[model samples]
Target: MGAFTQMIMGYVYPGKPLANATFEAYAMMCVDCGLTAISSFKLGLYMKIPPKAMFLSQVIGSFIASACEFATVWLLFSSVENICRPELLPRGSQWTCPYNQVIYNNMMTWGAVGPKRVFYPNGVYSNLFIFFLLGALLPIPVWFLARTLPEKKWIRLINVSTIFIAGASMPPVSAVNYLSWFAVAFFLKFVVYRKYKRWWAKYSYLLSVAIDTGVSLMAFLVTVTLQIHNVNGIDWWGLDVSDHCPLATCPTARGVHAEGCPAF
Candidate 1:
């Protein structure tokens, strides 16, 4: 959340010595999000409202969101048989539990153990530390150019966050996964929003919500079926099946002395 806040603050309001500004922007990030209730009142833009009423509404809304998030997570965890187990949830499995696994891995990597070892000499990804400085320095030029020109819309696209975010995200969502997804999102948001303003205003967010909700419902149904199969000892088409391709993950590590397999 601090990183999210930092990036948003940098994007919205560029500052001198952007690195320091970024670090400072998230001072409020550590604050309990629910404790700060003023922003919630801004939802009613054109009306004068009672603070107590707004606070109540905000609390209720937060409660709903929190409940839904927890329920969804529990629903998946309960229904998915051997979730987060790669052996059960193969490459294209419907219940791979990627999100949960990512949280676990991230906790292991940077939670208890500090990032020093990972970014120090002889570390596997020590080379990535250079990008941290590079990323921090990037906004200076963009900010300078924007200040000079002041009218070029294209200047906004020269965001350092874009480059570094893409670099980091590419490994998880490889070319095959993200190329077409990004292209479609770009076209819809940038092109369609400009060309079909009315349609976009009416349907863009609506469509996104509908699609996401539909997918969630479908996944829930799939999860229920999986749980049922587990209890009944019935077999069906492997809903959690995939290519199982672990490219660059050597067979030697898996007890196979295959030729050209790099043992880590």
Candidate 2:
């Protein structure tokens, strides 16, 4: 029944199927919300909270979050320039908004056009289906061992979904983001946690949360201020760069392909 609804949505909007796309996203959101709630539920259990109160709190929290998040989406979409304009953003511009593009790409792939058209024989991405099938089948044996043995530590090493999601995320995300994330993650995972166990247990997760919050809040305030003052962007080395940088306009390069960008 839902499949038919999605098809009708695709037809009604021809090249644009955002409604069905949002519907499908809502479905996935519910699933992930449940997954997140399971961890919280376990914490509640450990804390000896009454089940009724815990459930009520979760419901209230989810409702409040949904409202605030939707409002945030409206504000950004209404206020930001070049949000959907990939071409307009010079490299390193904060407005590149890879996260929004990821959703737009997914909607076009899975909502407007169905998976068979996108993943079947001779499709542009037909080769990726093998990984999909592999991901589906890979966890069974690992799950079986974990369930049957219940105490084996080695059975938890297989997490194909996380790997796939991260692999997909990297291409759309800016290189600077990945570089910074890897630097911090490598330090924590390999150096800090491994070599300084006591310090890590005391400060690692809290430090990560603080950094993420601070960076996000700063970016928001900076963007709002720039917009208010009618500023395009700073022309410093950090903000102004070619889309492909380091090679798009190097002194050694030749021809008008660089669009007359002064060789740096």
Tell me how far the alpha carbon of residue 125 in candidate 1 is from the true structure, in angstroms, after superposition: 2.9
TM-scores, in order shown? 0.60, 0.64
- 1-264 in candidate 1: lDDT tens per residue? 433444344434433234424343346433656445545566444357877787778779879989999997887679666776867554445455555454444433443233444334534555766766887888999999988987897997787787666655533344555777788799889999999989998899778879789989976776576543553233553333332465555543334475666554
Off by over 4 Å in 1: 1-54, 61-79, 90-92, 111-114, 121-124, 149-152, 166-177, 225-245, 250-260
The per-residue C-alpha lDDT of model 2 at residue 8 equals 49
Clashes of 2: 0
Task: List pairs with backbone clashes in candidate 2.
Answer: none
Off by over 4 Å in 2: 1-20, 42-54, 77-83, 86-93, 122-124, 136-161, 227-264
What clash count goes with each model? 1, 0
lDDT score for candidate 1 against the true structure:
0.60
